[model samples]
Structure formats: structure tokens, C-alpha cells
Target: MPVTRANAMSKENKKVAVIGAGIIGMAVASCLQRDGHDIFVVDPNEPGLGASFGNAGVFGTSSVAPMSMPGAIRQVPKWLSDPYGPLAVRWSYLPFIAGWLARYIAAGRPDRVERQARALRDMLGRAVDNLAPLVEAAEATAVFHRNGSLFIYRSAEGFAKDRQTWDLRARNGVQWEELDAAALRQFEPSLSSNCTYGILVRTNGHTSNPHALVTCLAQNLIKRGATIHRTAAIGFVLDGDRLRAIRTTQGEIPVDAAVVAAGAFSRPLSRQLGDRLPLETERGYHIMISDPEVRPKVPIADQEAKFVATPMDTGLRLAGTVELAGLNAPPNWERSRILLHQARGLFPALRDNYPEDRLSLWMGHRPSLPDSLPVIDRSKRSPDVFYAFGHGHVGMASSGMTGMVLADLIAGRRPTIDITPFRANRFA
Candidate 1:
């Protein structure tokens, strides 16, 4: 790949068009604007109100774990049948979802797992150092906080099973401390007596409000004079490897540079530009406790149900579950209800966690690749197009660093990490 003199000059003086105003999109927009590029952000909903809104708000830079692990593939059957189970897969759709499942299962192989782990560590290691400053630079210090996270297992069997993974975690430089039942009680007195074993990773962090962070980044982008338009991006105007303009619901916004950070919706948009990426949506639900008294000192991921409780500005946010349904499907509010139900299981006193789904509930589909890695490379099909989607469950964890990474690429500077591992055509 060669850096173009024209792109260098244009990036320094010409305009850029960014599709999606989600955290990933806005974060990239801010970075580009700061590095001296005019930007325009387009989205159908209000900026950040899509998948970026209502995230568990955890800054999980220390979390380098892959979604597919050694034992996860076997649990799909039981999970698919149970409503309140940790994960529920709709059995009827298994045929179509099987490709995703098969790919994920292949990732569970030791070699693949190890490789994916390294890639995740590369992204996460850069996230904390990169994201904190951006949060400050964007003037939203409240959005970034390092309170850490706790992973609690109710049974000794569960605790024993994961001890081996700690070695891999340690290899990635993530520090965690194990705690027995008594130690768990000592750490969080309010925790249910059933939480018998746990590990506390202090390197983790959380957001006060994910939506606030997204909006603040967009505001900063606007403050820097980036034009943000609300429109549905239909396609691209291509001239060889360069994208000439963006085809939107409103009109063709002539674009010298274009990036696809449209969350789960990135697939359709990317395909329209002649790029095919195996991106799937894992719809995660969050239930916020508006009652002021409800709170968790740090974000905690439940051992079984995959839910996590994070202390947000609103209150305590309990989010979890992965539904593989595609876009436009109504979120199963039943799943959100289950989050509320299990959150109470974590804390005995849950009188105020939000009375109904109308208040505390929110759902968003996180874009994920089967191997649990992100697409962070320039498109081979369109030299003017770049991909920054498929951060999967780690979007909140990796969004800001992704911005700097994108900035470095657009600026024609070598990235700090070997980006070849995240190439867009690796699936080939």
C-alpha cells in the first residue's frame, strides 16, 4: 500500500464523510477533524442513539477474552431452549445462523483461540491509553472512569474451570486477583451470598454514560466545524479505487474520504461498496436502575447469564444476553426483563432497578466477526474506503483507540501495531 500525495493534501484540506454517528463513527470523526480534515457525519437516528447508546458503559481495556472459548460451543443447545438461560439461540434459525456458529466453534480451537487472543490484546492494550485522553480531549471526562470489574461465579466448579484461562490472561498483561467466598463477601458486602468465587481485574474501567460520551464526541466534532447530517446512507460513488461521493437519503455528499463504522449495519453498506465481511449482530440488552439508591461500585459480569452490572450516571445498569437476530427485528424485551430479574439475584435489595421495560430497558446489536476480532484495515476494493467496524462486544472497550488508529491510517503514518492481523480480507 502506497500513500498518495493527493490523499495527503486532501486529508489536510479537503472534506471527509463518515457514515454513522455511533461512538465508533463519532470518535473517528473527532480524530480526523483534529488532525485537520473537514468531516460530515450521517445517520438515521440521533447521533449515538443507535447501538452506541445504552451500552453497559464499561471501559474494558483489560478484557482481552474472545467470545468463543474452549467450552462455549457445547452450551449452544441448552441455551437455545431456555428463555432465562445465559444465552438463547433461536433454534428455528439455526440453518442460517449455523455458519456463524461453525465459524465461532472453529475459533475455539486452541491455535485459533490463541491467535485471536493476541489480536484482542493488541487492540485492548492500546484502548485505555488512547481512550482516556480522547474522552478528556472531547471534554467529557465524566464518560471515562476506571472503577474496574468483577467476574463472579456462584459455584466452585465454575471457578475451577476458568482458572487455566488466567494464565492466558496473565500472558496478555491483564492483572486479576482471585477471591474465595469470604473474600468475595469482604470485597462487596452487598453481593448475594451465592457469589462464592470471583476475580477482580483492576485494569478495567467503565463509562458514566455511553450515550453521553457519543454525543459529546459528536458535539466536539461539530465544534470543530464538521457538518453532521441525519440521513440514510444508500451507497457510494466510486471512481476506480477512490470513492467520489456518498449516496445518502438526502443527496450525494461528495466525499474524498469515506469510512464504514456503522455498527452492525456496516455489512450492507460495505457490501454495496464491493466488500464482503462476515459480520453478525449480537444484540445485547441493558436495564438501567433509575432509582438513585441502586448502584454497583464497579461493573460485574455474572458467571452464568452473561449479564453485567455497571454503575452508570443514571443508576445501576444490568446488561447482557446475545441474540443473533439481524437488523429490524424487534428486540425481545423478555430478555431485558430477564436482566432485571437476574440483577436482583446479584443484589438482594432491588426495589428500584426501574419498574418496567419502558424506563430501564434498552437494546442494541453489537457488530461481531465470528472469530471475535474487529475489521480495522483499508478496503482492497476501494482505496478511498476504510473499515472500522466489527469491534464486537468490545466496541465500548476499543472505540477511542480505533479513532487514533484510523487517524494514523488516514494520515499515511504507520500504525503502532501490525495492522495486517486485522486486514479486511483476512476471511479470504
Candidate 2:
């Protein structure tokens, strides 16, 4: 496959080390490779086994609304009170996260939310288009489905409550159609009749298998002369604001430039580069049911329950939830159980109990920021060192564009979108 230079600037190629093998890291590598850069990826774990492996897989182009929307704080107290609620926080971790919570709440102010939404729209709106080239290169185009997604509500009141969010999406050029009970049922017969309202974002799409998609891209990179280092990136060896090489557990690997796409583990590396970002882990969980009796035709998000039921090649994936328990906390299986209970309610045909072999549960940390935006900028200390983490919940959907933008920055070309909102020093 010939690399496309339409988005490339100078033909100069350099040794680029992408730190992290998740979807974001691989996507960045793919774009850099497309621009003819010598690329290598670094990670300790198997590629794509982190949050990218277990996300809902929705392209979520319409998901421009920041997580910290207006009136979101009022519901936090109620959400915290419920153990099985969509949001949870380990009480012990609250003190450590208090400052982040404050900033999160402040980000919800109407003015800030508007700016955040526009920025998110610019990046996520072209998700599928941006990812098309990489998907083609990987020969995994079949892994993606453009059948659209549903946001169904159990009651008219619940639907009305989200009007502002829908309005925000509309203002950001997101196209969606309102569906009543009959229409919702006709669109997704597998859903329970309790869902009375829905909004179909026809422009959105989803990956049938996120892990496979990322692995294919990684494999493609390797086939194209890129290397994958199965080791942890500990630090960097710098020479007066220029990255000389990356320090790893195994030893140092010389590189002309580096990217910190390490997801939840990127904070310390950023701090090492003189950028103290307020990056936190929003621990998310998912349950996969293999050979489900019933599955939605497309991804369906229960607006009130705050989880998504996505039909995947492996089976049906019920994924969503925000648990702020930090990165080191043990897995909370109870949260996975809550998803099972919610799934039964969403899909009445699903069995109350499934054999352990038929079910798989996962918990991974989503690298999140208070304002629900990612840091896709060069380091304050070195232009060669770029930051591309803190994507929060939309990493899979936004990875393609993030990669293109990073490649443009690295190649000294203008990014296709405005990246000011994603600057590392925004919090400062």
C-alpha cells in the first residue's frame, strides 16, 4: 500500500518512538507511518489489551458534549450514594481526587462547555473518515460498522432531561433523528418495550471488534518496517529541550522524537517533560456475552442507566460506567454484576444467569481529564516530545484524528483542526 502524502508536510522522516500500544498509540503510529516516518511502539502489555480492548466501540461522532455538563454536579451526590449507580468513587480516593473534582465541576460552566463541545466536535466529527485510510491499510475495514447508534430513554421525562445535550450536539453539526416508542421499537426490536424514546445518530458508527481492529493496525505497522518494543517506558534522556532517547525498563532506545500516548500512565512522563497535567484514571468496566440470545441491531445506549449494549463479532458487549478508584485499586466485580443486571433489564430475552464460560468481564483505566478533552500538543520543554493521552471515554473514536493531528504537528504541518483546547498547559 502506498502512503498518502495529502496530509503530510515535509518529506523528512525521523525515528519516532510512540510510547504505548493502545488504540491511540497505534493510531498515531499508523499516521506517522503514512507520512513515511520510521516508527516504533513501546508498551509492557500486549497491544490493545487496555481500555481500547473493552470500550463500547462506538465511533460516537455525536458525542461532543463534555462529561461535565451543566447540572452534572447536582447528580453526583445521588450517583455516589448508589453502589450500583453509573458513577462510583472509592471514598478513600476522594481526598486525592478532590482537586480534580473541583476543576471538573468548574469546567461544566456553560461558557466553558460551549468551547469544549466545539473543540470535541472538530476532532470527533470526522472520526470514521479519518480512520478509513488506516482501516484500509490494515485490511480490517470489515471490523467497522456504519449502521449508526441509538440513545434510548425509558421515559419521556428522561428524554426531555437530555434535551440540552441533544441541542448541544445539534449546534455542533451532529445530525440525529428523534424516535418515539414505535419508531424506537422498529429500529431495534431487541430492546425492551420499556424504552419509550430514542435519538438515532445516523452519522455515528462502531467497531465490531475493537481489539482486532487495533491489533490489525499494529500488525500492519510491523509489516511496514515498524518495530514493537514489549517493555515499559520509564523516562527520557533529553539534551537541552530535545529528546535524545526514551529510557525503558530494558534500557534506553535512541530516538529523534517521542510521543507520550501511555494513557493512564502518561502523567508522570508529562511531569518529567515539565508539563504537570491533571490526568486521572476513570476506571471503566465491561461485560461481554458470547452467543447472546438477543442483540441490538446496532449499539444502543440506555440514557438513564448510562451504559451501552453494542453488538460485536465476539458477541454482545455491555460497556459503560465511571468509577474513580484510581489506578492501583483492585477489580470491583460488583460493578460488572451491575452491568449484568442492567443488561437483563435492557434485553428481556437475555438469561438471568449465564454459564461462567459464556461471560467475560473487564476493568480498565480510561485516561481522563476534568474537561473531557485530550492533550494533543507538543511538550513545553521539547517540540520533539508530543503528548496524546487523556482521551477519557472517546479514545477509540477519536484516535484516528488525534493521530493525524500529531503527525501534522511532528512534520511541521498545520493540523487539520484547532488544537488549542487540547494544550497540556490548559489547566495551568
Candidate 3:
């Protein structure tokens, strides 16, 4: 497999079309624009309002653990039975998701899990550091902060069960501190008494407002003279093995190269380029309380509850959960409600209710591959087409690195990091 440099597909003064206005697309556009390329962003939805708007906002530098791990298969039955559990699969959609599910479970094999973790470490270990320059350039330093993040366990047994995961994180060079009950209280006094153990990752950080960060990036890119088209990309116009233009709802727009970064909607578009990726939407839910009584000092994740409560600029956001329902299915707001319910256990003083206008319930699709890796390679069918979707739970965490590597690829330069694990045709 020979690497296709951007110069081989197009000249240096290239016009690149980025299909998506979310974090991934906007980041890619900003990097390209900085590299002196013409950038046009396409998206029918408002920029940053999808999953980017509602994530927990944690810049998880130590998030090297795969969601599918040893014994994960045994927990599936419990997740299926419990309506408010962290994972859910709509029975009607099981057949549609069965194949991906099989691959997901298989990825949990011990050897495969270790390989995935190593790849994640290389890809995400510097997430916050990689995004710092971009944050400064966008004048979004206020929105990005490094207060660190905490993972609390309710009992010794629970913490012990995850020893393997902790070991893997250590192997990946993740820095962490173990805290007992008294220390946990000193770190976050608002935490419930049930949280007896804690692991603090000082390298982790989060955004004050996830949506604002992305919007700021887009605004900064526009101010830099990047063109943005508020329309959906329907397909691509190709000349032999090269992409000639993108056919959007608005009209055909010529381009030198194109990238599919449309989040969950990227699957169909990638198939247009002949990459049959096993992409699935992991529908995530979030509940925001604008006037919460108690706010955690930083982001806090309850090991048992499987939700993360982060203090945002506007309010406290409780976000987590994985639902496997196709793209067109209506949101199950009940999942958001479950987040609220479990969040109260983490912060005992949280109010039971808030003004209807002060609370927001949101559900967005997270584009995920079975092995929890994103495709960041040029298309096998056409080097003029590239992929940068399927970051799954870490899209926000890994967006900056993804953009940097993408820009490097587009500039006909090898990425500083080896991206073989993220090849677009790995499923082949």
C-alpha cells in the first residue's frame, strides 16, 4: 500500500471541500486554511449544534480504554434489561446492528483490546496539547480550561474490577492519582458520600462551553476568509479516479479534493467513494440544568452510574449513554431523563426540578466504528477523497489531532504519527 501524497492528486493551490460544520470539519478547514488552501464547508445544520453542542466536553488525554473490553459481553444482558442502563439497543434495530455488535464484541479479545489501546494512546494522548494552538488562534482560551477530571468509584470492589484498565492506562503513559474518601471530599466536596475512591487525571481538561468552542473556531476561520455553504452534500462528481466536484443540494461546486467529516451522516457519503465502512451511530444523550444547586468543581464521572457531570459556563451538564438506533429514528428523551436521575446520586443537593426553559434535553448521533478507531486515510478509490469520521466517544477529545494529521496528509506530507491503525479500508 503506497501512500498517496496530496501533490499526486492535485497541485499545491488546491480548493478543498469539507463536508460538515461540526468540530471535526471545522478543525480540518481551519488547518487547511492555515496551510494556505481554499476551504469551503458544507452542512445543512447549524455549525456545532450536533454532538459537538452536547458532549460532556472532557479533553480526555488518558482515555485509552476501549468501551468494549474483556467481560463486556457478559454485561450486555444487564444493559439490555435495565432501561436506564448506560447502554441500550432498540430491539427493533438489533438486526440492523447485529453485524456491528458482533465485531464490537470480537474487538474485546484481550490481544485486540491491547492493540486498540496502544493505537488510542498514540492518537489521543496529546489531545489537549494538540488543540492548544488552535484554541489560542481562535481566541477561545476562555472556553478551554485544564481543571482536570475525576473518576469516582463507590466501593473498593468496583475500583478493583477495573485494575486491568488502569494498568493499560499506565502503560500508555497516563498520569493519575488515587484518592481515598477524605481526599476525594477534599478534591470535590459536592460529591456524594457513596463515592469512596477516586482517580484524578491531572492531564485531563474540558471546555467551558463545547458549542462555543466549535463556533469560535468556525468564526475565526470565516474571518480568515474561508467560504461556508449552508447546504447538504448529496454526492460527488468524479472524473475517472479523481473527484471533480461535490454535488450539494444548492448545486455542483467544483473542488480539488473533498473530505467526509459529516459525523453520523458520513457513512452514505463514504460509500459513494466505494469504502464500505462498518459505521454505526452511537446515539448519545445529555441533560443540562441551567440553575443547578450544586456544581462539581470539575468534570466528575461515576464509575457505577456511567455518566459524567461537568460544570459548563451556563450550567451543569450531565451527559452519557449509548443507544443504537438508526439515523432517522426519533430521539428517546427518556435517556436524557435517566442521566438527570443518576446525576442526582452523584450530587445529592441537586434540585429535583428546574424551570422548563432552564433545562435542555438533547440526543445526537456519534459516528462510531466497531473497534473504536476513526478512519483518517485517503480513499482507496480516489486519493482526492479523504475520511476523518468515526471518532466515536472521543471525537471532541481527538478532533485537533485528527485535523492536524488530515492537513499533513492534504499537504502531501506524512503525518508525524503513524496512522496505519486508522486506515479507511481496515475492514477489507
Models ranked on TM-score: 2, 3, 1
List the pairs of residues colliding in candidate 1: 57-207, 59-205, 59-206
**Which structure among the candidates has the greatest lDDT?**
2
Q: TM per model?
A: 0.93, 0.97, 0.96
Clashes of 1: 3
Give lDDT tens digits, candidate 2, residues 52-111.
999999999998999999998899889878877899998999998999999999999999
lDDT of 3 by residue, 1-428 (tens): 11123343348868899999888998888888889887888889879987788999999999999888988889878987998799988889999999999999999999989989998998889999988889999999999988789998997789998888899899989999999999999999998898899999999989979999999999998898777778999999898989888889878888889988999889889998889999999999999999788878889988888999999999999999999997889999999999988988888888777778989999989989999999999987788999999999999888999999999999999898889999987898
lDDT of 3 at 205: 88
lDDT of 3: 0.89
- Global lDDT of each model? 0.80, 0.91, 0.89
Clashing pairs in 3: none
Return the lDDT, model 1, position 107: 84
Tens-digit lDDT track of model 1 for 1-428: 11122344444565778888988998888888888887878888889887789788777766677889888777777987787876766556567778877888888888888888888888887576678777887899866787678998987788777765767777888888888999988888878898898889888888888899998888888887777887888888888878888888877887788888898988888887667888888888887767545566788888766789888787778887888777667878888888877877788877634546435778898898998888988876787788899988889888877888888888888987777767888887
Each model's number of backbone clashes?
Answer: 3, 0, 0
How does residue 243 of candidate 1 score in lDDT?
82
TM-score of 2: 0.97
Error of 1 at 68 (Å): 1.0
